[model samples]
Target: MDKIIESFIEDFKTEFNYEKIDKSKLFEHYVNYVLISKIYPDRSSLDKINVGGTRNPGIDGLAIMTNNHLVTSQEEVDYFIQDADLLDVEFNFIQSKTSESFDMGDIMTFIASVKEFYKDGELLFEDDLLNLRDLKNYIYKNSIKMEKSPSLKLYYATTGKWLGDINLTTIINSGIQDLKSLDLFSDVKFIPVDGDKLKSLYREIKNKITKEIIFEKHTILPKMDKVTESYLGILPVTELVKVTSDDDGELIKTIFYDNVRDFQGFNKVNTGIKTTIERKNANDKFVLLNNGITIVAKTLNKVGSAFKISEFQIVNGCQTSHVLHHMKTSLEPSIFVPLKLIVTTDDDTINDIIRATNSQTEVKNEAFEILKPFHKKLEEFYLTFEKDVNKRLYYERRSRQYFGAKAKSEKIIGLSTQIASYIAMFLNEPQSTQRYFGELLNSYSNRLFLDNHSLFPYYTSGLAINVIEELFRENKLNYTSKKFKYHLLLMFRIQVAGAKVPINISGNKDNEKYCTKIMEALWDRENALKIFKSLELKLESVLAETKVLNRQAYLTRAFTEELLPTISNAKKEGKLIYYNFQKGFGFIKVNNSEDETFVHYTELSKVKINEIVPGLELLFDIFQSPKGAQAKNIEKKDIVKKSI
Candidate 1:
């Protein structure tokens, strides 16, 4: 197969002048169309040439016909020869090309040119040329008779690449159908010639013609050129001047170096300018005398202005109070102003103030100042600002950069939950608010929830809020300023109770009752009551403390100590743990063991507990055992340090 393909490619290269043809591939399309059109007899007229010219208006090319009269151009030969005896024949217009790729625009342009030629006063005939006006008159006189003749057609002939996949037969048939729809042409035909076929036809035609018909050598067409131009204009300058001060010795030296480097290759610098000094005090009072001498002995005067006699002094110093003022008045509007000032002052304090102000204009100066203080408060403020800016920019960029189909769905649920929660909180109705939050949490979990680090916090927080809100609502607990404290205490106790512990409770046993006992002890209840009663007391306590305790502050403190620390420690120890307070249970890996242990906070006794730490040995009675190993007897053991 490879050898055959290679041979085919070699033959293709030698068969045609590939570079000369604008569309070498078009030859394949014409051949495919001609072959396919032969399959349908009803479309046989599609194989005919189209007639169109000024003197001999319909002179496209030969057409496919059963009779010899149909083979000739009607307008040029048969019409005049037959005279009143009109011969009826089917024909099509012929478009000849030797290009590989054909553009739609080129086809449109050809159609437009044809339309313009026909509209001109000329007609193209076979034997004698006819003007467009004569052709129209002939068509008008024989309109009904011409309709009786076979319909006109459009024929395209090319010697380029084929338009099929491989066999060169299945070209898109839409182009053929479009040709038939034309009012002037009744059918369409596409004829393709390969290099061998084209050579054979040329030889055959040359032999058939009695006169030597000159054939021009095919040459590649010129392509369109694209060019772009830009312009820069020189502005007219009235004058050029440089302003400086005697005190700016350092700046002057640096400027001089820069100017020398910039103009090193230049011939010379333009220096035809005048210089002047206008001194003024801070109060805008002129200091120069009529004779340029001090009225009184030169001395420090708070209310008096003084000018020192010096070359290269600041120009228009009275009109310009500062460096910014001087730049605005001196420089052109298009030029950028240099943000530097030179002030000559004898007072050390005044010089210090100017130096400090100058340094502040630099980008690194603010960062240096922030580090200099080294105060915790200031450091925290800087960090906070940095983090806020980063987060704000990240979200802003994210919102602008991406939009997915799921975004609408996510936003709807998120916004609804947020609005509902705010309303519930503001109304101080914990139960209603909790139900709303639960709906929100479930919605989030069901739809957008993914086990990603950034999303997990929101998932957990939503779940926690939902659980607490539901408990408060079910128990009719009213959260007040004083009760807020006990509420947080209860929340913390619940969290600690839920910490990792051995799960020995049987699945068949009443888990609620066991959890109720643990809750009663943790909340310091009167006694171990029913599970429902314990839950009620817990909610009541939280409600009472809400009046005095800051809810957010309490939650944060408790979370940091009781929950976050243990999680952090577990991570540091390379242990994996999963917690779900809404379910009142959590799981932690047993040290050096493949087994995982489940703990129920509802069963733990907070009052009896002391100095609880992870990995510390403890004993608990196994109320029920379903699977795996567990501790049955509940008791505390001495802390043991593990060896590395």
Candidate 2:
């Protein structure tokens, strides 16, 4: 296995220029081969024959079926079919190409070439046409057949480098429907090869070809995916000696030895320690000795003696109290205690002394000893640290919300544009809106406009202005005002101005004069202004009366209502009241039991408000009682007031 893997790697480097391949990727290739083999077991034992290349214009390879018949070219495909005695099964053509990558264009080209080879015009013998075209046509015409049958299959085997280059979904979705519609076979399959799979198969083949494969192992660690390596080295240590004065007026010398035998040859070593001791009396002298040799001598004015030693000999010098103190201060705390007993022969003896002395230490000195006992609690705190950090993040978000900071200016601008587009869409119907603008609005809002884009108020206003100007220019209407305000106002209500109309009393001077005067009056400044003011007042009044109505209509139809129904019924026994058609217009009923009081149309004038269309909503104040009911006042509601 190792030899095969190594050979695969070498071959991969040469073929694909990939020096380092992941083991999992290589293994996937072998797995794919095993799966394919299991699915098509019969193909494994077919005899391998070199099919002539396209340059030679002949078969590229020949594969014998279970029977001993030879099938050479596509034209001889039927030979095996008829020779059941010698050929009991069918074989598929395997076209092999060595490529750094495979692509859709390559597949298409291969298919096209195969189609050209078996084309109707390429027949050599009359029977050859029947031999090649029969299988080819059958496969192409019924590519999606639901039943299995004897058929010829085409296989293009190449290095799978191109598999990753294209979207597999696109390739599958693009031609899958067409392929399935062909109904050629019970099923059709496309296989993509990758570099890893190819390497594994190549290794397997190379191992079979060469009985002995060479495997090599490197001592240097291969580059890990996401890791680093570090190194540490041990240094040699030398022995030392020290001298000190004991509390009982006795001179003591201690020898310190190096634990590593490699440093035993060193007799003397430098000491990184300095200390001073005062004598009790004058004229006192002391000499420090190690191994019967006087290493240093010093005199003090006091009775006590003092000595200083800068260097010590490994074999002859003794370790004094000052020397021990210097060693402790010189080395790092982690390694100081371990190195102090280097001169001791038995590690167990030193450990026992350390344990006995540690027990005598006070609680304050043993603070570090609790670390082992509280390790689990420390681990729990570490695990929950992330959760605490998340809570702090949540608190920050809450604070931001509470502060109510304005959105970024850029975002505000973007939102304003989006809202403007939305309002435009709402005013106009969706169908008339530009496709791109509609797309932008819909994408931003994640919704479609309900009203037609053409019916937008702004668009309608522009159209109305255009119609009025056209009428004025044609002399159909007169615009005497400085700015044609009345004409503009009339245009808002002249829904039929743009509609087609037939001329009445054609060529009659009297009729023409009357029509001209009427047009002039309609376009008159005062009249136009009157109409404008009327419509404006009406809009305001309707909105004021129907605060929820306009919003409801906007939510429903996004337009003003043109007309609404009103129904009236007699509520009391009354005689017929005379109708008033001049000043006010409405039904009037007189109460018979009473003194025949008249119920005037003026009493219901509040409900007589107009311009009640799909988009307009009106508010009615009703004076209701058992005797009868009547609307006292009509008004438009304000949405902003209600919102506040």
Candidate 3:
């Protein structure tokens, strides 16, 4: 492996906590992460797009995007169907190779797999891929909702350089033609990713993007406190497209508002903008009709007529920008867009600008959530634990707030992740965690991030979520349990502090105490792992008997109600009856019963071999192993220390 690629993989492992995953497979995840981040940098759940498991049919990953949002399950597709009249969907397929060179055989096999994926004939594939296929079918079923035919994109990545060999290009072009014959996609393209390009993609994620544009026509706005400089200008539609696009001329999705108010596909307002651009002699008047694009930059440099902006975001003109980019080819050079460019590193000022500029539009209130006082305080609270590795988590109230910082990506909790984690662990809404962010915010905004809510539980939940995901990546928990991770966090909290809801408001001492208990258990790595393993067993048992692990189960409360008892019942108290310290095996007398459950030293986190004693009251959970019912996750609670 190239040293740079090796370093990239190591960083990927740390950011995603993939150390326990096989090294050979890490390259696939690396490719997926880099490429997907290029499209959706702030997307929280990368695993939802990963399908690189057993019987994957030569494809390493797949992502089905509806209106720029990555849709994993059929439920998400249904939501889009109900939410929007027209959907702009995209199907992305990826194949990654760690080998220094790409083989023609592998390339052909990958292309063939994609071709087969669209076939009506039955074929065996991994469950995740099957789900994606089902989702694809669901989208097609409601073709009326589609704004246009779905776009098909394929990416083949390898460590070798793509020298653009004519033979390889011809082979790939031929394969693309075959797929295009299916007539299922508006456009079909296969992008070859080479070693140098992969490195560039990886750097793009962490680096601040800089773009220079001509700013010949502009009026400087009045300066205000916290604002370094502000300008109102008219920029050519061509130059606006340049700022919105990448080197490949694809729209850079990350450089927009990090909220649910994404590019709404060809809506009335956008259609109006599109119509205005297409009208003869009306292109020059576009600056007067459309609300201009607002550019917020951390730093701006003026060189003659060109202005170079770094770390810029288009705060308010998502709709306009998308429309302009879509109609770029038809746009006349005389077409101009109204531009508002502000330069500031102050988050407060940026947030205010974003809120003010978007207030009149159809943007969701959730878009301005980071501007809330609670989030700002929560951001501060996360810093208090920075020196303590066990409780440390960097709260990202803004997009890429922790970028280039020393914090690991795994430990950097974003607002969406935090909301889901807190709602699951503290509010007991694990089932609702998967719902649309707009819906979650609408329903739970009053309950979460309140002015008086104690910040301790938020931090505790964030840290617990981080730990749980790490355990899942490490395979300490059953892989299936990853789907119900929010449930596991709820269960973990119940096991540590009981099922009672804490009064988690400011000045509430009990809230701090309650959250502290959960924190203590999570702070101890061994104890946390034991608790999660036992909870996984309980989760598996509940899910097996009910056989209700589907979209319906997750969207309803009945499944949560059914699963809660299993976790509540996990608390089994027993007295140690017999032990062999030399061999480290024992039996526990069930609390008020004569039945003895087997126990082992391996389940003990607080005790050593000789620390075991007869008649010591133990708190544990029972796991039905091949041998028999055995006590696992044994806690040395209120030990009597009686002699045998």
Candidate 4:
């Protein structure tokens, strides 16, 4: 072990035989470095993220995030300053202890400390944390005025056994309830990062994006006829609980990273689910009352009666699994949950399954970001963003940099879950306020709920956000009003209506901007009626687009067999102007057009790479790739003699 690990182990050991280890910053560092980093992949909270003091206000650390939906002020037409004292930012509170076990007292102490910070928040030191205190005070002072206010997450980190019970959980629930009753903030969630959870989190961070899991069969279920479908069976709760409560939590974490809803940690509905499982008559109605878990796997093979799944995701039943794990020892041993594990290697199909099944909750969705795997069109659209003032948003493809807690520009133009919700809501539920967004964001387009292209790409939807933000700012709209919220949603709906044959917004560029093409569609009377009366929205457009996208996605199939042409633009006569048979690459010069494009041997017909010499005449279509325009579907053409 490294010196830090060795030192922490010693400190952790001392607590097993005694009341507490000597107060040291080592435990603080361990929780911050290992536990926090593992939980938040962005490592959003570091350096200035921590704010513990002599008499720490129950908070060992924090990450205050500004609301992305803030309306730009008239005073600042372009941007807003990221002063640390920015009001109404989200909060993630951290409280760490170097203790081996936490009893009722410890749990209550943690809650009390959290409540204390909210109630009696004072600047710890006159010099340090002035900015943070100012921000907190601002949130507290103007708590009622905000629409979706700052969220408080009290994270308890300890190198100890989590002594969970009815009383401790009830107290935490009561605290959350009290916070909500007043409507001071958007929401408050409590998370306990005990020693086991911490260790699991650490392991998860060091692993791959996807993880493999084994499920021993309880009984074989009926199978679907689809090729993508798989080993239908019952997964014994007792056996699968091991994966849920693993020291590495890799399976559960990896599965739910992109999940829309999360384990709300001791909510009323979850408690009811727990109650149903633990009741005396539980086994009798367990199968009927309980909605079984949905499992999606990249690849599955039967290991005797057991099934090993690679690149698997538990799209639905996350809360159920969490409840099962939390109340593990108290449950019946013979309990088994029905598993519908689809065994396939398709990435798009897996996302389809996830979006299809994760709709049992009552939580209002923030966005469709979870189904990002299927949003390639948007990913492609974002690349076309011309970096003007209007093209500031980043369609985050890779990192968690989109939702970082930093007050910098990286935080400004990041991928937002809200963006998806807006696109989905406009297309799915434009008129209904009761149901803000559609549950079938993935499935609504097609019954199969596979890869659908009707869903607005991040670039277009993100641009909508920018446009509305700008227009609203220009009109001097308030950020927190019920009317504004509805109008904002309507604005998105209008834009979606216009996109079938998109209209241009700004006077300049003749509607060149893709966002403007979609945005400008809002004003046309005919398009507006088609969208509102006929309810022809983006959802419908996306649903229609999916068929084409699915057919187009079969590029590999096109290479081997007959399929729809992947390239557009009518074939133009071109010369295999320059050829390098040894290198397997050449340049093509169009017959009439002066544009000379590169072509690879692989891009040519499935002939041998050493087929022909230079100056071979060819006909091909020009298509765009990451490396500019390239000649595709090269076919040899015979040179014809003409009267000279």
The 0-to-1 C-alpha lDDT of every candidate, in the order given, reads: 0.29, 0.30, 0.82, 0.50
Per-residue accuracy of model 3 over 1-644 as CA lDDT, tens digit each:
77898898898888767889987688998899999887767547588777886677579989888878787665567666766667888899999998888788889989999998898867688766776786788889988888689999999999998888888888999999999999999999999999998988888776799999998899899988998998998999899998989887888888985433688888888789888887877877888998788899999999877999999999888888888899888887688888999999899888888888887866666666778888889989999988988778899988888777888888888877888898888778887787666556767877888888889998999999899888888888877667788988988998888765656779888889998999999999899999999988887777777756453455456677667757756467888889887887889998876667888777776765566778777887664332456776677765533421
TM-score of each: 0.19, 0.21, 0.84, 0.42
Which candidate comes out best when scored by TM-score? 3
lDDT of 4 by residue, 227-306 (tens): 45565556667665765544533334445544556555445677788888777777656666667777666556566665
Of 2 and 3, the candidate ahead on lDDT is 3
Best by lDDT: 3
Ranking by lDDT: 3, 4, 2, 1
RMSD of each candidate relative to the true structure: 37.3, 40.1, 10.4, 22.9
Candidate 1 C-alpha lDDT tens digits along 357-387: 3342222221122112222222232233233
TM-score of 3: 0.84
Q: What ranges in model 2 sit over 4 Å off?
A: 1-49, 55-93, 116-119, 123-147, 151-154, 160-169, 172-181, 202-644
Candidate 1: count of backbone clashes, pairs at least 3 residues apart or interchain = 80
lDDT of 3 at 334: 81
Question: Order of candidates by TM-score, top first?
Answer: 3, 4, 2, 1
Q: Which 10-residue window in model 4 sums to the lowest lDDT?
A: 70-79
